[model samples]
Target: MPEPPRPEQPSDDKVLRGLVGAGPSQLSTHAALRARDASQPTDEDLAEAERDLVLVRRRYVPTQNLPPGIKPAN
Candidate 1:
């Protein structure tokens, strides 16, 4: 059997808008990851937090597509 084609990745803006419980200034999963792991990362703690955040977000949040009950905001 052949595999079905995957849908395209949504724009970063759309992803941010669709994020549940996200604040307007809050960074996206990837952004947070960069923040925490970067040399500065506002020091270091935030970088570690951001790295952990990436893991958590990848597991729970939608990346290229969303799971049920996680529809994108218009």
Candidate 2:
């Protein structure tokens, strides 16, 4: 039998927002569900997500230049 049509890949902006610290929007979450159902996510998608995640994590972390005994400000 002929193969089914593959689902469309997510836009770079959507993937970046979803993977990073930003919470997923309803539309992006729905798109991800569709992609998962269709098994259409590509390696580039995964790599981009990983890259964005690292960047997001670094952005939120406190700077390391504080004095040894200094605690984070409330």
Cα deviation at 6, candidate 1, in Å, is: 5.7
The alpha-carbon lDDT assigned to residue 17 of candidate 1 equals 68
Clash counts for all predictions: 3, 0
Model 1 C-alpha lDDT per residue in residues 1-74, reported as the tens digit of each score: 89998998888777556554465645668976775566464546787786554333433544576545566554
Residue 1's lDDT in candidate 1: 85
Error of 1 at 16 (Å): 0.7
Task: Judge candidate 1 against the unseen true structure and give its global Cα lDDT, from 0 to 1.
Answer: 0.60
Candidate 1, run of 10 with poorest lDDT? 53-62
Q: How accurate is candidate 2 locally (lDDT)?
A: 0.64
Task: TM-score each candidate.
Answer: 0.21, 0.24
List residue ranges in candidate 1 displaced over 4 A. 1-6, 20-40, 44-74
| Candidates' C-alpha lDDT | 0.60, 0.64
